[model samples]
Target: MKLFRQVFLSIAAMLAVQGASAADARLPVVASFSILGDIVANIGGDRIVVTTLVGPDQDAHVFQPAPDHIKSVARARLVVVNGLGFEGWMERVTQSANYRGDIVVASQGIAVRDRVEEEHDHDSHDGHDHHHGKNDPHAWQNPANIVIYTQNIVAALSKLDPAGAALYRKNGDAYIASLNELDRWAIQQFAQFPPAKRKVITSHDAFEYFGAHYQVRFLAPQGVSTESEPSAKEVAGLIRQIRKEKIRAVFIENMSSPKLLQQISKEAGVTLGGKLYADALSQADGPAPTYLKLMRYNIGQLLAQMKLN
Candidate 1:
């Protein structure tokens, strides 16, 4: 009878533990787009259900939220964003929907890069500059900026779920370490091309951070957002620049249609280096699923096709 009672107590304790574990499950989350989704997944893991407002292959720069998107946001306990004016419509939509959840600005305290007209020569993407805030919103293009993202995520998640604080910190640390290693690799790979050959033109000015960090010169036909289709005159002007500068490659941005870029490539007589992930992360099965992987894949392809003869 004593042995049986001990066994019964052990079984009861195990059941109690399981019940408590289920009760402690975390809240539902919603990320503005793919990159945020990836970062949240890296930390949220199995603790929370995460839904992306704009997923991979979708253009967040021009994402018009649907009824389902609003429903998801309303149901979310937390919403992560890349703040700095990247998603202009986010604030209004969330406010309109009365979302009272934690809105985490992933790039909260990171040092912003200069994006004034004088800073860059190309006047192609002018008049559309949304450089109102402290820094450029394309912080994800520079891996160093990701440190701020990870930390902000850790703090936000901890505030929302104190019990999972340690787990969130651990995941952020691991992911940041991986991003640091990627920074080194980017420097090395980008070094392969001589300074003169480091120039490439694209459909949009989404690569300012990438160019600034890797010493590459990026000329965008359109403005910052992919939604801004350049006028025919602008395309002709870019074609002239490509011919005069003998630019190595014209890259197609993942978020934008390749049709416009193809036209530029054909007119300029330059090769389309590769597709660059300008605004969002790649699909789970694609090459640029994670932020780090996206950077490496983009830089590698650029180098391979843009290397000077």
Candidate 2:
């Protein structure tokens, strides 16, 4: 009996050591939001464990980080952010956590679009600078920009985890290929319609990159950030544009309030088309759970509504 007990104890100890080693092997990473988290997970694969500060279907513009987020950041070896002034609260969170790690800006090398330019192009006549002349942080709306994001992530991951450099490169290349394919698909899809029929309206001005990439005109009542509400004049101007343009494709963003869009649709005499995943992604059980899925789902929604227009 003593010999059998000793053999079992040795096996258990070996199993525990193996489990701990496996756990220790994975590098801990913290992403600013769900969309970025999904992208990091695709590139990092099983080599890293990711914790997202803003979860799926949540608005990052009004996000309030808690103690758990600080703890996650503190434990992470690397922190990833979208970094076009997207996460206004990120600085405070990182400082409070005392995180001493590499911070990766995923949108680092992309061609940035200015909010003022977007406002002018979209025919926003509100005369209000919603973003205060800041750059649009929704670069991920364009698949081409996400290619840059993927490359940046790969470089950051490779630099931190030298042992996993080859794996990161391989994964990043695959993701970039997928992104290219998605962009090509989008171009072809949008090309089928005339430029006049490529106009859409959503709750917020989050699709400027997307609009520029596919040559679609996206009109919105609110500005880049969901925190910025549209004034009465701004809302009236958008309603007039919708009526004048005969635009029937109206959508509500998954992360934004539907009330404003509902009111716009009612005043403009257009039915609410559907929900588009803009700043954040949907839950795992819903349509968009991953970055790729989010893009595809949003494209599908826009196309369906644009068909009516």
Candidate 3:
């Protein structure tokens, strides 16, 4: 009985040591939002543990980080964020959290376009201020932009965990290939539409990058951020423009308020084009759970809605 008890204790010690070592092997990362979290997970695979701040179907535009978010940041090995003023609150939160981790701006290499704010220049916004002259932060809306984001993620992860460099590279390369495939597919689908009919209306200006890349023109009542509301004059002008241009599809974004857009659709007398996953993605069982799925779902919605005469 004594010998058997000794063996059981030895086995338990060995298992505990193994668990500790396994825990130490993982690089803990904190992503400012869900989309970035998903991309990090794709590259990190099983080598890293990622904590997302803003979850799926959540808006990062007006996100107020909780007290726990500070603790998450402080404990992270790396912090990933979609820069370009997208997460205006992130810097302040990280500073307060005293996060001493390597910060990676995923949208580093992409050429940021100026957000057009003429529509909301005079409107009273509720929580946050989203002015148009600022740089648009929704680069992930474009797959080409995501190529840069993935490269940044892989580089950041490799720098943090040198032993997992090969895995990160392989995973990043595979994701880029998939992104390229989606790009080609989108190009072909958009090719079938005439320039005039390819116009779209989304809740906010998040899809500007998508429009720029795919040759579709997107009009929005709100600015880049969902915090801003369009004035009555802007709505009237948009209604007139839609009537004049014969625009077909108007979409509601997952992150923005549907009330305003719904009103716009009713006033404009156009069918509400299905919901587009803009700033954030859907739940796991929904159409857009991953970054790839988000883009495909948005594209599918655009194609289906634009096809309506």
Candidate 4:
């Protein structure tokens, strides 16, 4: 009985050591927001563990990092950001955390779109401070751009974890395939609607890439950044434009305040369309939990409303 007990104890100790070693093998990665978190998770699979500073349904525009976020960055082996001046606080957070890891700019290789200053400047009144950068940061709206994002992520992950390079590339290729399919479907869906009926209004200008790619036009009261609040004059002007164009596809973003859009819809004599996932993803139980589902849901909502237009 004593010999049997000793053998069992030795076996248990070996198993515990193996388990801890396996746990230690997982690379710690941090992403700026939930959308990127999901993408990184897909690429990393079981090889890396990911933490997101900005969670689902939270706006990254005005995200204030807490102590936990600082700790997350400090411990991360790799950090990823959208990098079109999207997360203005990211530099501050990384500085505070004193993170020394490699930082990956997910949108690094994509063709950037400059924010049309004249269009926004005309709408914004005096004393209105525009907070967004010169270029639009919502590149994930275009799946083609996400292809670039996926490639960057794969390259970053593989560099950090040479052993998992094959797996990361495999996952990235599969994701890019899905993105291509999504792009094709989006093109077909938008092609069914006439150009005149393709205009839409939302809480913010987060869909310019989507608009440009799919030939749909999106007008918003607020600028690219949700932090930029429109003046009464700007809101009135948008209301007038909505009326002039007879645009009925007015929608609110998941991460933005609906007060402005609600007011616009009521004053414009048009019913408010359903919520659209713009900068952030919805909760796991919601319609846009995944990146793929988010685009599909937004497209469905837009089409349903554009049919009325």
Candidate 5:
């Protein structure tokens, strides 16, 4: 009888250890950039451990993956990326790391706006041709597209950790509701401006999605990628266009240099509209620390620049 009791106690200890191990484990997730990292955190909450490769105010357009990032991706149960060709180096990094985990494209199913369509939309009133790329990967600029992002994130997280599915869905639903509200708010707010007054200049052509949704026309001296420089002729044309259009303000992006934009503003005789967050979020205490705050802050800054507020 004593021997039997010993064996039972040993089994109970093993069970306890197993339970503790299970309780201590959390889902590991890796996101390509800061904006997507925030969205994943919102859905995952404390149920997952998230690592962001490109952090706040960091430019993913020219991000270089570190060894630490490879290590993180190697061990992560799931990897999240902004697909629309946004993370140009992500595939190579994952391949180099031999990351075998599931990769979820957060922007999946979000209607991709190619550069040709973007140029057509921007210059619809005119017959000017724009030398642009084939794809514009900044879909998150539109709050409506964020709905698709939240859904994709929730689905991916739920699939990876079914036990935490309910919590992820709840968080995702709440966040998406906020996005919907933001969409409505932006529509109403931007409606205050007439089409003629909705034009502005930004550092890069990152706001095509935002412009499509908000009826605001964004003109940029540089192409979609900040890594590329605008030629002298392009700059001259932009200056002429700004002067002709009476574009009141030219804004600098959070992740781009203000020198070129400042130069454009000076030569174009326009005010420097406050810095806008395009590719990444700002520091913790800055105007656009969070994704939601980023959208609101951008609209507010632009509206204030137009004296519409």
Candidate 6:
């Protein structure tokens, strides 16, 4: 009986040690927003635990950090952010949190474009301003941009947890392949539409990357940034342009309030392409809950609304 008790105690002790080692192996990562968190979750898998600074469907453009967010940041082993001035509130939060982890800027390798004059002005925005998103904080609008985001995440994770480097690389390669497949698939699906009818009217100027990549036109009331709202004059002008160009399907952005766009649509006699995932992901079980689902939802909506007439 004495020997059996000792044996049982030995087994329990070993189990406790094993649990501690497993816990140590897992990284505690913090992402600035939901989309970044999802990307981290995909590549990190079981190797890392990710926490999103901004919850689902929350606009990172206007996000303000809370006490809990600071605590999350301070606890993180690595911090991943969209950068390109998308999360204006993050720097202050990180400073307050006094975090010492490596900060990963996900947009490092993306090719950025300038915003249009009517919807944006060079002097109107500077670094660390949401308006700086004039270059399109909606980089995920084009899947190819996500390749760079994945690469940054992989590099940062590898640096923070070298043991999991191989897994991160392998996962990133697989995800990139899937993105490439989606890109080709999008091209093929869009080929069904005529070129003259390829033009689109979105609530904001958020789809230029998608337009450029897929050979479609994205006409917008606001410029390339969802952070900006147009004046009534601008709306009137856009309405006139929509009629003049015979634009089809004005889309409502997932992150922006749809009131202005809906009013414009009413006056213009154009259908509102409901709920596009622009600057953020939707809450799960909603439309565009995931990146894959977001793309599919947007494309499906566009297809349903777009007409050759």
Instruction: List the pairs of residues colliding in candidate 2.
Output: none
Each candidate's TM vs. the true structure?
0.85, 0.93, 0.91, 0.92, 0.88, 0.86
Better of 3 and 4 by lDDT: 4
Which candidate would rank higher by TM-score, 3 or 4? Answer: 4
Candidate 5 backbone collisions, by pair: none
Model 2 agreement with the true structure over 188-221: per-residue lDDT tens digits: 8888899999999988889999998899889888
lDDT digits (tens) for residues 1-309 of candidate 1: 999999999999999999778755657888898988888888877677788889987888778988888888888889999998888889877976789988998988887776632223244545353454344578888888887898998889889999889988898899889989999988988787788888888777777888888998888777767777777776787787788788877788787888887888888887777788878888889999987788888887788767652
lDDT of each: 0.81, 0.90, 0.88, 0.91, 0.87, 0.80
Steric collisions counted per model: 0, 0, 0, 0, 0, 0
Q: What is candidate 3's lDDT per residue for 57-85, written digit by digit as tens?
A: 99998998899998999889999999998
Of the two candidates 2 and 5, the one with more favorable TM-score, higher being better, is 2
How should the candidates be ordered by lDDT, best one leading? 4, 2, 3, 5, 1, 6
Cα lDDT of candidate 2 equals 0.90
Worst-scoring 10-residue span by lDDT in model 6: 120-129
Off by over 4 Å in 2: 1-13, 117-132
Look at candidate 1 and tell me the lDDT of residue 177.
Answer: 90
- Model 1 lDDT, residue 66, Cα: 86
Better of 2 and 4 by lDDT: 4
The runs of at least 3 residues in candidate 4 whose Cα sits more than 4 Å from the true structure, single-residue gaps closed, are 1-17, 117-133
Q: How accurate is candidate 5 locally (lDDT)?
A: 0.87
Which lDDT value does model 4 have at 25? 86
Model 3 lowest lDDT segment of ten: 120-129
Q: Could you tell me which 10 consecutive residues in candidate 4 have the lowest summed lDDT?
A: 116-125
Tens-place lDDT digits, model 4, residues 1-309: 999999999999999999999888899999999999999999999998899999999999999899999999999999999999999999999999998999999999899997753233334456353444479999999999999999999999999889999999999999999999999998999889999999899998899899989999888998889999888877887888788889999999999999989988999999999999998899999999989999999999999999999
Write down the lDDT that model 3 would get: 0.88
